[model samples]
Target chain A: MADAKPETKPKKTHQERMARKKQVIDERIAKATEERGVLILLKGNGKGKSSSAFGTMARCVGHGQKAAVIQFIKGRTETGEFKLFKDHPQIDWHVMGHGFTWETQDKTQDIAAAEKAWAQAEQLLQDDSLDMLVFDEMAYMFKYRYLELEPVLKALQNRPKNQHVIITGRVMPEGLLEIADTISDIRDERHAFRLGVKAQAGIEF
Target chain B: MADAKPETKPKKTHQERMARKKQVIDERIAKATEERGVLILLKGNGKGKSSSAFGTMARCVGHGQKAAVIQFIKGRTETGEFKLFKDHPQIDWHVMGHGFTWETQDKTQDIAAAEKAWAQAEQLLQDDSLDMLVFDEMAYMFKYRYLELEPVLKALQNRPKNQHVIITGRVMPEGLLEIADTISDIRDERHAFRLGVKAQAGIEF
Candidate 1:
């Protein structure tokens, strides 16, 4: 004999299913929010790596964190970022103040600038009070042999365990990647330069 | 007979002049370093603002500072920055997860997503424990009206006195400028998009 009771199907519409799915996803995200510790390597031929690094400095300052920035091979004149941060009491901003090698053409001067900047960076690296340190265009220093790789590697290794650091420029050394908790390669597929377009104000800069 | 002593003039080379100027500059910079409490605004269209912010985040984490990020209008999928920071136990990396309205044709959905993201950001704004807060692409939100202006103004004003904040994206509102202790407008003289070149991976994104 057939059962007297009829089977009842679950009543869930497509929207309801989606809502449920979203709730589940939200819960997972909330759970994941507790975990944090990241190392980011922004590489590639993109135009904004340095800009991005500065952005972080602004953020840190806003939150009351102490930060230091060492600019290598990019100090030609006063940049907007430099001007803004130069007088800030919270930041320890240092500029090697040497233009690129192509501009300087003096091996001794370039090396001297690199050494001077590296010295400051080393000090910051060892300072436990600094919350963040930026080695702007440091990769280029190693790539161009302006600074020794071994010392940089050693400094990074020996840096205050709690101190954070950022190194930016093209062509990152493999050793950096090996030790980096996070590595990002900024790939270049297309750029405005190939089209002979000048960088626009407030965009390319 | 006139007895005239030969004039003793010290001729200075360009390098020597430069060295003297540098010495003065270094002294001024060193003095500036002693002061604290600097605020900087990294604005403009040039690339690197957000990248710099993330770089700072990495540094903060390395240094053991508590940090957080609130990304607006950049949400589509997981970004490299988000992915890198998501699982870290020390950071609070939150993405609004709604791609820009220009990219998304659905205005209704865009506004909804923006509101959701704003809710999360509001929570961060109210929190006192956050050491650094990076508000990525916030200008776009203000420009697009994805969120209200008054509340944003209020939240920023009410932010923890010592907390650091970074707001990025092009075309900042006048209000933000007035309240910001430091403001940077990134001027782009040219861009790849004008040249009809595609954004290179790692560089553009």
Candidate 2:
């Protein structure tokens, strides 16, 4: 917490150690008192970037919170996540991507797709009834400059104070990270693909 | 693919650029043709470690895949995740922790709880009917040495070859990370808790 006591005493016993740690932790817990929808950015090359985004959205359903998602850069019906949340309640799910940029080389087409996705994102940002909004792989759209940064920033800044928005992708746009309330840059010591393990159903996709 | 041509050509047109990138990507995609269940590890001090794990389990429910989970460290029925997956089919869920280490100072009682949880984990490991097995916060048990390493390793080694396992927590055990097929060390540059924002109902739990 903001007023946590500094560890100056020797914690020789387990009881003492716990007491010291608890004193600090309790204060930290007390310091966190705000209750509002947060903007979470899951950015990195690691897996679970989108999975984490989708996972939180899934939690919203069980907790009786309304949520919506606008995926950019890539969308596919074959994905396990898409199949699961396609018809679920409280999920205004939209997979607006054609494919990964590596697969779709046409920049103009990709830009058009991104713009369409952004339109939906803007709409979601404006809707105050929603509780969570996910822009899966929206970073690619920003990184590629398919859409201008001003509108995206404006939407994020002007969205309903109670609506949590999650942006996920490999490269964290420096500007976006600056404004996000929480930024998780997921990384890995090693990757499965590097060692010849292929992406599997219900695991990677 | 294994035999993909390196990008040596200078692409002047968008069509040419797309073709070049697509050729390499197609080959890379072709190279990954194997199908097997993987061991995924989500570990770090950052948020979303458990969210990523539970989210995937939720995905399993909708995708017709059987998934089981054993949550260690802290298990409370009031969690949003518990409310979401309590009645879902194809899920074998078990919450076997009284509380976190800081809350429960009794090592013996904690060990007993971990053993009970491990009993369920061991059972799931041997079942072979499950597609995914999640050891939610199991790393804490391992790090604390509440559960022995030998039996756990043996179970993992002896489990069904195609079964996927997910372990999530901070400070991943060295041994568990070694055997895990995939590892995501989620890191947040700035935690919301540090910023005095409390964990929200749907977002944190």
TM-scores for every candidate against the unseen true structure: 0.50, 0.92
DockQ scores for all the models shown?
Answer: 0.07, 0.53
Clashing pairs in 2: A1-A28, B1-B27, B1-B28
lDDT of 2 by residue, A24-48 (tens): 8999989999877788999887877
Question: Mind giving the per-residue lDDT tens digits that candidate 1 earns over B1-205?
Answer: 3788766888876566666666775555454322211123456655456766675555445445577888887873334455445677878877775664534556578778778878888888788887668888887777877778888889878877655677777777877776664454544433333333333223344
Cα lDDT, all candidates: 0.64, 0.83
Error of 1 at B115 (Å): 2.7
Q: Which number leads on TM-score?
A: 2
Q: What lDDT tens digits, residue by residue, belong to model 1 across residues A1-205?
A: 4867775877875456556666775555454422122234556675556767765555555555678888888774335556545667878878784775645656688888888998888888789888778788888888878788888889888877655566778788888777665454443433333333333222233
